[model samples]
Target chain A: MSTATLNVTTVKADFPLLGREVNGHPIVYLDSGATSQKPRQVLDALDRYYEEINANIHRGAYLIAEKATTAVEDSRAALAGFVGASAAEEIVFTKNATESINLVAHSWGRTNLSEGDVILLTTLEHHANIVPWQQLAAERGVVIRWIPLDDDGRLDLTDLDQLLDGVRLVAVSAASNVLGTLPPVRRIADAAHAVGALCLVDASQWVPHYPTNVADWDCDFMVFTGHKMCGPTGIGLLWGRRHLLDAMPPFMGGGSMIQNVTFEGFTPADVPTRFEAGTQPIAEIVGLRAAVDYLNAIGMEAIRQHELDLTAYAMRTLTERFGDDLAIHGPHDLENRGGTLSLAYRGIHPHDLSQVLDQHGICVRAGHHCAKPLMKVLGVNATARASLYLYNDESDVDALADGLAAAGDFFAF
Target chain B: MAGLEDLYREVILDHYRSPRNRGELETPPAIMAEGFNPLCGDEIQVYLLVEDGVIAEIRIGGQGCSISQSSASMMSAAVLGRTPDGAREVLRSFKEMMSIHEHGLDGEPISTDDQPGASGLGDLEALRGVVKFPVRIKCATLGWNTLDQVLDQTGT
Candidate 1:
């Protein structure tokens, strides 16, 4: 990408929601790991789409309907290209990453996994990824194993060889939402493949924060939510190998996913469509495509670098200011982590801290972050989390530090 | 930065840091109640020592946000020696106050002189400020919810 086109400040300004104020102060939205703010381009694309062409794709023959169909399929190819998937057929649309994981668990897992088969996951997985497998295992008598984490929250990869002995599928997060640790996905993928096991990468936290190529990672399936990547909420992508997607049974039965239905039986549509049942999230998919384009324009490399720098800045600011009173969970090294820090204030609870931060117009998450097993491993009920995205700069870090200090004083007094 | 004074009233902070009657009761037939805030994963466990329809003692243990912990502390301090009926009345008044931001407890002993003022839930009054901060409302009421469960279990 050309530096002439890369106007970082202008790009920041394009995000209209980021301009809003909270609690009589300019909102310092550091919770992008949860959901990112959309840019004008993405929002406008949705507006232009609805105004010009609004119709169900594939079946419609009218001009506007054809345009809508083209737009949807074009976005699909764009998204597939973005992930470096072998074909557009590999990309299936779902409501969010959770639905994507559930689709796989219900469809592929139900068919393949049986009694005595082992499914391996990590403690750092979101409830969405963990629960589906747990529910499946319970029904099929399959065993679930978790990869433990070290003190700094990096997954303990030392026991991978032993753990993979009977593992049928390895479902792991590319990055932890709570801890910010970016696991070695490629290595994990290689190990899983060696054992003839399918690998599913939950890249919900990693996709927006870093540049990812599914082909390079070589995972059997990859899932990420659009909302987390500065797109609309209802759309997410599940990229699977075409061969694997073709082999798996359909997840849900409804419109668009069927070729034809007869009294005798029904034949399912091809790969991608077979997994996506019902009316797709049309506007959201369009917005997601715009989001992907926006990021591509910015160059994900620059974004990743900027975030790494911000993470280092945040970690330094937090530790130096609070000392031992603050404990930052996750990998101590910034290189192995995403731009997230879940910290516990020694005396004050995360809820109190978040309340105080909210008053300051500093938005941060305070809780288990939907990773309760990780919380249990960390030995804390909850932690105050400040997650960063592209819009976050050094000033946000300063505000967070100031807020944490204020929380300490208020509670200590 | 907005000072914590806006949210953490001095009384509430005091209760949180040094909670009164924050522990467990003897294991024999204690009325146990648990409350959880699924949003934040905050949890509280409360045990009541009930004898002859009066709270002989009240003990609470568990981990949660400050509002819940302090509220639990204040709740324990308020209802320890009261009759189950009195405690239930106070609970009703407190719930009313939290939901509406004020209480007009009609014709109860709570309205009498020498009793605390409108927000004057006594130590429970420390949480009156919680109504303003909506998210903390769950934290403040977690203990009271547990207390409600305990009340239900004992059929009082």
Candidate 2:
């Protein structure tokens, strides 16, 4: 393994769930791509929020309300810094990444898109990224275009110019949840800008494992979730360019989002507040801030480097153990991929494989992973995916290998 | 480990390796129904040729995991020549076996009788172990559920 600056063993010790046993074996969690295990820091932050400062934010005159409001805004500022946004006002909090994407689709898409306009997307998107556009296209009579994938699972951008001809917006993923392929978002964003179209990135899988600078990416909008970054669920972020957010209409209309109360007409508040409708998830935001602090303490570069080393080690180990019996999907080069590994093995079904692996206390995902279009392109109905994160180590990879060997032996003719 | 062995029995593997009734039936007299387990991307299409209230022929198609495919294979073998009401009874019996009911074999003794139509489930008892694995219970029942839908649509 490569020399990581952060100590993974110490990091793993912070997560209480990792210490538990499943069935009779120690639990080896390799499913962080679905949702990461939370550290004690985040859990404690959430607990502290409920215990010490619990109140409705933004409207109350009580001291606790002021503290809650400050804490929530502080979290927004920290998350903005995490993704390199210029100001906290640019970060709009929503229920989750899925809701963030839907907010943009309802607010910006309905306003900007017209009949015959095109929304270009990539095949690597999750269902959250695909369904909203499909719904919008069906509603507005807009045409949707796709950027295809190469044989190795990276985006085939050779036909990108042709696809961008009438495109009004280009929405794509920064990383593939199934294939682990990291597309060049900067280039795609630049291409979209050259053609006078906007660019939106689904960074749900990217920000957790790597350092994300939305300004450096030069995209019009970006989104990510808190749960995938070792925080609590029910809180996610949508970071958009200041001008674009100011120009769009409010996503939800409610008490906190309005500037005036009248039956005749009402003016919406400023960008971020206009997007947040009801009472916010205050405890989740506090947990997210703590998660950001935890990740920052370890350093994003160190996490990325450590995952790269683990990915290489995993690929080498699995290939040595299974050889041609295993078919791994994604870019062959480690530099072009993340730590997610989706595998098809020995004609053993992914569900059966997952069941067998469960006997050994190994947690892996089995199925389309909400990327059915990519699964169709890969020519498989489903794949077993084992994704890695900061706390995962070489021993986890060994356990996975042992589990797969057992599955092979059990299913052998 | 014994749970795993019970789940992937030799008979289940045999059917998965060499599935029976795995093609299409001519459509003039055949009714088709498709089932999908969206959670796992397992898709199965069941085609039935019914004549005079009896299933004349049955075919299973599509792709999925061993449990789903093998279950479909075994289902076609069990229901091919039975009448629509008989097929419905068989479906109910199979679902009862897969469900968490108190009257299930969990509290009762295991039986070794292989007599046809003696135990109400016949070879379908091979899939009894699926109930233990809650997540995979859907995979094991995709075909039978589709067959139920098709038979319902065909007015039985």
Candidate 3:
């Protein structure tokens, strides 16, 4: 399933945004890590769902309502299958990855965590994974510990046993959005289970780029977003073990999540419906199903290989062209990294550099990347980040290099 | 290349490399205000030494992008010797020059050199190109906004 057999140009053509121009030049979109451009397949799914099957799911007995309900439930099943979940009932749809984590924090954290309990997390987590726990910890008087990062920006796992002691939950990102360093999720999950702690993996960055198997990773809970994987926004997924989800209380109280409601109290529904409180994003779930189908058609292994090749080529080209003037954060090797290149060029502010690059129609993210804690740890305010996807190729990387060289020339003293 | 030159003029880079009033004022009766752009992690602190309703001394301290730091430096140079009202006028003029509104000066069919209130802009006119880059406008005006906060705090 290597990308050598995959025609990269045809893949690029699938995304309509890739064909557009900006600022009188062809657009080189390298910000897929922030949000991926949707392919026509996913877009068509949304359009068809609205035009043909627009109805409120789960309540109405009309034909269109039944069709809409089938579409939404079928999407859950397909998404569960894509992530290798044991059953579709274990998949819970939410607004986005942020709400997915917050659901766990509010429901599971409020129930399980108490005073003197500790929740361990890694430094590479986005604010989404960090702030929820911090809020829960503040309310419950619980302690929070961190897994430090080594100089190369990979998680320092040498003291995993010590950090896991007295820990009730361990949350970590499978891949750092800032550094592109893929932490060993399987090892971390095994260690957390050995310590009798439930492990949660933030797969927002990992599931979009790599071959993800919740069963293989053996994590207790996992979450990822649809928009980052060529689907529409306003839809995400949370997959947990059936037993854990059943035991946890409902995160939000509403109509769809309850089985029986009295004037006094309510009895919650089963595992997934217990979490989906209100009406879900029906069209987005359908679009997400189409996105999953598109990825499966291309194959995750091929996508990973293509991104690795592009990453290797970008690292070499940028290093050769800029020399010491360009410094890329994270691991130098592509073995444990993805196609995200966070670069610092000769004291040029990332905002300034990104503005210069934008003039050439090269889009790159220049900010803390929602990982301000990681920014403080790395001793930088921000890095100009150029992230690649399956649609990107070596020419896009070359265009990035040329834009950076122009930045140098423009800002040269 | 022409647009790039317009945005990062030699005067802006010169101020970035060797900033004017690039320190804190130890004198008393000075008001300090800090501005931060959480998006890009740009932070700038402005200190003003106001006496008799005039900014007798001004100093800026922070770390940020070239546009921000250079704008702060040029802002210090522009308003150092002006009274409180005069400094506010300078701030308003700079904002006008950097404004990207539909009916404001940025939208007018006029050259950057002949822009209204060009005489009041002095070296601050180097930032006129920021109007073309909408996202970077915050970087160019972070210092001016902070100084406005400082002035408001002084109640003058």
Candidate 4:
């Protein structure tokens, strides 16, 4: 908050994992797209939670149990604020983003959707968003339509009106994990609403890198994971509109989600509680609160600005260094994309490139990035992705370029 | 710490550069089967031409990283003239070569008797370096697994 830009050195110091070495070399972690390294603040929060206030939340009545309940609610409120949601009860914590999406498909889709109804999705969706809808379609005989991608890898929304016709729900990713293309989420939400359809944005990649305001986007539902945002794993967020969640049934039924059980019929709790069953991820929620605090301390605007500069540097460096030998997928417009770079080295396989980079202690993900449909659009089975976060700086990008050069030489025929 | 030279042996790179018996064969006479490493989107297809008890001919199809493609090329070359039982022998030996070092990775002692070269699998022996990188073990075995599936499907 004090500074306009994030000091990469100070931010890097906050994360303990970056201080560690791999294979006798300093680690250049560029795989933030998969999962981010935890900051000491978040780790300390976890330690504090387990040591001081480990108990079942939402049901316990004693001192430590009450403290645990308060901690979980406080984290929910923090997450609601982080995503620009007015009500804390709108946030339902799931295992991760995949589970969050599934909760929506099962609770909302199962209750509201029927046979022949259409769910419009884009090629940019991760398997989490795509498969849930496909599962719903299989069960209900619902039809699924696709929003194609253009040559620039952004959504081709030329036939938006036609695609929205008869569509009950529209699900799409805010920023593509593979291509880093930031679709027009607000415009899509507006169009879907015009046709009396609901919109859900899978912001798993977008929320960490950008300033998010759910109210501004006006989407019915949104989802993101914790570990990807420097929080602990095993916790995720699903923020829904009050009206939508009010009508939907509970996703999972158990002790915490029930109001009363009479051994005959049971009454389910309200909204978020109705979805979160069993003992909640108390320690993970505490860690998530700390992660949100850390991000707030640095400020999201500063983080986005940092990544914008770093991404430009990375694109220029890779092009100058590898020339036509390497092709980086996604939009060239700086404002339309995030810092994630999905690379295809002309002759070298992504798996081999990843292996070679690993030897040099450069961490990158080599896979379809859980967006197999996007990979098909890019004409690649898999890609080596190097994504940037607030902790990343220009030197990490330089290290990646150098490591790639070494890989080229090592794999040379 | 598996060195690049270990995984990318000259022979493995050679096979990857110029794969032997590449592309698919006729599926009617040559039974075709596919294997997938879902983690990396690595898919390998094996087409087998069986005659009596012999694996008369073989072709490797599909695409993946070096460990997968080169292993397929090497497997095709090694098992071309051998009977199905003899090919399974090489498959078992290759599988063993890739699995032997996994125990060493977990700090368990690996016997000196099971050296990669001790198997004497010829060009296929070069893939032993794959075990040092545990995640890549699947890539190295993708070809062998697909071939084994096809050989068994035909009851050869």
Candidate 5:
């Protein structure tokens, strides 16, 4: 094994799901861009919480209630520190990145944006970022504008100033789900800030692969999901400036988010709690903290380097083997991309391509990947994507290569 | 354990490479049905030339996985020139066989002849292996679903 492989394997021991077999062959999981596999440490943390201190946080004066409250607050603090935020109050627990984006769209978007005002978003954003704004625009008569993408799937920064003019809010993904291109986010944020527009970053694909500093990016709001980062599902986070969150109205009204309830009037709680109205996913939060710690232990910089190297290897080997028959989507250069590779065989459907890969125990995602507008822009109905994460290696790429060849031959007479 | 080779049988590859009845039908008096797999974005549009309750001609167009394409290719060939009732019976049999579980027709024969007495699938029997791979079953049934939709339009 190479040094990267050795490092990944050492990390694999912590995740039990990596050792399983699918279709009677060792599972070569290449679908991490969809959802990552969880580690034993994360699972153990969840189990420990349920077993030891299962109680409604801040509800009762009992010892367990205090312990639960401490655990939740401690996790919030850790998460705040992980993202280099000012305080735990800046982080609000959400269901997923989808909910976070929706919360912002429904709360700030409905209240602030108006007719003739434009919401600027990148052409390559996930549906979560695009659809919410589109819905809000349709409802409120706000005009929606797009920052066009280049041939390499990178953002076209040439018109950044023009696009930001009169834009109430700018939303974009940190990384494209299909092309894997990391946008010039800091520059985009700076441009948006210059125009007095709030920039929201959908870091669902980026936070798992790289270290994220909201303060460094100076983004007004950011959203990410836990499952994509090897944490439990049904849990995500929305990080926003304390002032912006405080000013926005409550997204959902419920018991915990209210300071005092009366027949005449009800007062809202503070920032994060005011947004998080329902009983949160307590276990998922605990598990996400463990996932954060796991990433910290391995170090994000080293992991990012490992993934970059793997992506380079995959691009080189795949391009050399299949040539033009394998049409790779997104950026041409590895440095301009993330770990996801969306490609299509010349005349074969992605469903067939994925089936052949499944036979080799290689898990890959196939289809539009929830970016239909981008798919129409790319001029294809669907494409097969093989995504890499911390646990993937050269062998997995080899499996995908072999599977593509088999699909090519099978589809050909 | 069924291998990839088993999943991609020679017959399936043959049907996929040189699909049968792969064309558009005449527009007038033609009923069309489309089937889509949201998971893989596989799609099929089936057109039938029906004449006084009989399937006078059948044609299909769309893009999909090899199994779905091949299945549509074979389906257009299978149900052509058969009465709506006869075609539904044959489709029912094909669906039953594709289920893979025991349905009490193991010893019985499926005929492929176009004559009034011929009543079973001969070349399509190769799809029996698809039962081992459950996900591919939908691929094999896209054309059949279209057939059902066409039959539904026939009011049979």
Candidate 6:
């Protein structure tokens, strides 16, 4: 309901990399699904942390150490508030979203899951969400079932009762990185709860685009990364329900994640601290806080509105231009999707299409996009994906269309 | 655009359009090797029929981008009459041609045991332009790599 619209020009200018040229033309990056380009504000925040507050956190009596610890805690709290978590202590920092899921699969999966227990996943999950569970299933004799997709790429939950029967955990992605289908997470969570199952939301795609509320979704666990949302790399956030997180064992053992150590045995720390081992990524965490502040100032609802509107415009433009020749995969309903568009044009090989686009300085990811299973489901080897973020506008989409037209001419029989 | 043209020459395009020897032979009579480029999920399979120490027949399979598919076509045509050792020699020369820098053997541009037509690799020379676009170098070499693997399996 927020009427605050983003000024595309101003937002575009804030990203330093968007101004640079590639191959004698202005760069038009549409690969935010892979990783978003950081804005100047987020970039400056990293520099400021290194210059002013560079110190190892959590174990220092010195002034800079205290400051760094405070910064790290503040980032945790900010991220918690951003996602509507009850307490900052529930958020554990890890290397990336993949590591976050692995942390849960290794720690929580080992303790909670037994042989013959079922972990239900979706066909739309990225390999990060899928592989960890597979590893868990391999180690423990857990049977995995998939919630299949409909013809239009949305999750078909007609048999939810049967699918959730005796399921211990339901791990699903909030959005499909390839198809851009926003799965009905809240409904799925409710169904999962009805079956006495734990629900873990892989929000690596959804958190960056939409307004996220863990309590509203009623998910037991959620995980996402920083780099996709304008923060620096080497940092990811994992939020778990307080009781579950407290009960779960530590994932990695090292210098700092312990309360006490003995020759015989060792005692680990509590909650988030128990999970964060070794020297933490203080600067990147600080950068993440700055990124949250930036998004908060703009407001996530407004950002969502901008992207949704842009996605609609793009669909219309591309369809109008190419008609039957171009195919944009995913749901026809714009209300239930994000700004990611996986394009297939006139049967051009994705690699060829990607190469042609690069010459025009239009960067689109041309591969299986770490979702090889999804690729098989789509019945294509690969796709050229043009994903939009807060900074992208109609001009970027126009440039993509023009580039595709040029590719058509180049590959003409 | 000029760089793209160099990467996708007319011969490369023709080979992609109507690929030569695009199939497989029986298992006992032929050896098959498959290659996959993890970067783009494109795959290729090369089947070789060795008779009298020479490749009596060659066929290509799978699908990929222009560079990968066309390179396979050109490779199938090139190694038709050559011995397994001769095919390996051609692979070395083809890889050398596709390398961005002259990856000489111990500070030398050419290896000590060199073939006569290493520089002039016939139809395979169209792939030399792939060096300009470094990423597509993998695509161009997918066929040669598969053939090399199949030959290694054959042990001939």
Question: Number of the top candidate by DockQ?
Answer: 4
- Give the TM-score comparing model 5 with the true structure, all chains together: 0.89
lDDT of 5 by residue, B51-120 (tens): 8767888888988777888888888788888898989988998887776332323533323322322336
Chain A (alone) TM-scores for all candidate structures? 0.97, 0.99, 0.99, 0.99, 0.97, 0.99
CAPRI-wise, candidate 6 is medium
lDDT of 6 by residue, A1-413 (tens): 56798888988888999999999889999999999999899999999989998999987899998999999999999999999999999999988999999999999999999999999999999999999999999999998999989999999999888988779999999988998999999999999998899999999988888899999999999999999998899899999999998998989999888999999988999988899999988899999999999888888998999999999999999999999999999897997788989999998999999899999999999999988888889998899999999999999999999999999999987
lDDT score, candidate 5: 0.85
After superposition, candidate 4 runs with Cα above 4 Å error = A1-3, B112-117
Give every collision pair in model 6.
none
Residues A212-260 of candidate 1 have per-residue lDDT tens digits of 8998899999999999988999999899988888899999998889999
Per-residue error for A136 in candidate 5, Å, reads: 2.5
lDDT of 3 by residue, A119-238 (tens): 999999999999999999899998999999999989999999999999999999988899999999999999999989999999999888888899889999999999999999999999
* Tens digits of lDDT, candidate 1, B1-156: 324564577787788778888888876678788888988998888999888878998889999877888888989888988988888888887887777643322322333334346645766665665666666778888899889888888775
After aligning candidate 4 to the native by TM-score, how far in Å is the CA of A260 from where it should be?
0.6
The lDDT for every candidate, in the order shown, is 0.85, 0.91, 0.90, 0.91, 0.85, 0.90
Indicate whether candidate 1 or candidate 5 has the larger lDDT.
1
* Residue A401, candidate 6: alpha-carbon lDDT: 97
Span of ten consecutive residues with least summed lDDT in model 3 chain B = B101-110
In Å, residue A6's CA in model 3 sits off its true spot by: 2.3
Which window of ten consecutive residues has the lowest lDDT sum in model 1 chain B? B104-113
Residue pairs with backbone overlap in model 1 = none
The list of candidate 2 runs beyond 4 A from truth reads A1-4, B101-119
Residue-by-residue lDDT tens digits, candidate 5, A128-184: 998889899889899999988888788889988988889989998999888898898
DockQ of every candidate: 0.51, 0.68, 0.58, 0.82, 0.53, 0.60
Tell me each candidate's TM-score. Answer: 0.94, 0.96, 0.94, 0.98, 0.89, 0.96
User: Which candidate do you rate higher for DockQ, 2 or 3?
Assistant: 2
lDDT of 1 at A188: 94
Of 2 and 5, the candidate ahead on DockQ is 2
Residue B85 shift from truth in candidate 5, angstroms: 5.1
Candidate 5 ranges with C-alpha deviation above 4 Å: A1-6, A161-166, A406-412, B25-31, B83-122, B147-156
